[model samples]
Target: MLNCHDATFLLSQRLERDLSVTERANLRLHVTICRGCTNFERQLPTLGKAARAFASHDPGAEDSSS
Candidate 1:
């Protein structure tokens, strides 16, 4: 069983790199039983999308709008 801290770390790492089967299994199980982690996992995609959108925005583009 993964502690909340470990589970959260794994969840974030998964976005950056691939996890082993065991790691994926553990994270999946943990999130299913933990409400907080589950919500955190659910928000991962939204967070990623927001990050990508922000990264795609250029300072020059913003300056041009003014």
Candidate 2:
């Protein structure tokens, strides 16, 4: 059984590195039972995409606020 902190940490870390078999199993179990964690997992991809877009945005490329 994993606490929310541990489960969330695992979720974030999995994006950066490969989780062990046991880690994946534990995280899956935790997210399956935890609604908040489930939502967080589902939102991870969208958040990642948004972050990449923001990072690559050009502040001076165009003036849209007129």
Candidate 3:
């Protein structure tokens, strides 16, 4: 039974496939009942798209891997 706050926190990480089964299940349960979290889920993809666009536009940005 994850709360809205927890759901938002987990949403992106889960989308990245970084969450454990238990955490994913909890987030799913929260999004099932919380409209706000559900909306947040809907908007998550938009954010990812924006981030991808930004990175694509900044090819010369310093690599963080070093």
Candidate 4:
């Protein structure tokens, strides 16, 4: 039984990283019952894509992976 706060945090993490089995299970359960969190989960990819596009167009942004 995850609360909205915990669920939302995990949702963000899920976008950027792989969730463990436990985390995936908990997130699935929470999103199944919570409409707001479900909507948030659905929107994550679009937001991530927008961020990447924005960064790609910025001339001063440093690539930190190297």
TM-score per prediction, in order, is 0.72, 0.79, 0.70, 0.71
CA displacement after TM-score superposition, residue 3 of candidate 2 (Å): 1.8
- Judge candidate 1 against the unseen true structure and give its global Cα lDDT, from 0 to 1: 0.93
Q: What is candidate 3's lDDT per residue for 1-66, written digit by digit as tens?
A: 777777898997777678888997888888898999899899999999998898788555676556
- Output the number of the TM-score-best candidate: 2
Each prediction's number of clashing residue pairs: 0, 0, 0, 0
Worst 10 residues of 4 by lDDT: 57-66
lDDT per residue for candidate 1 within 1-66, as digits (tens), equals 999999999999998899999999999999989999998888989999999999998879668757
TM-score of 1: 0.72
Candidate structures ordered by TM-score, highest first = 2, 1, 4, 3
Task: Give the Å error, residue 11, model 2.
Answer: 1.4
Per-residue lDDT of model 2, residues 1-66, tens digit only? 999999989999999999999999999999999999999889989999999999999987777675
Cα error, candidate 4, residue 38 (Å) = 0.7
* C-alpha lDDT of all candidate models, in order: 0.93, 0.94, 0.85, 0.89
TM-score of 4: 0.71
**Candidate 3: RMSD over Cα atoms?**
6.6
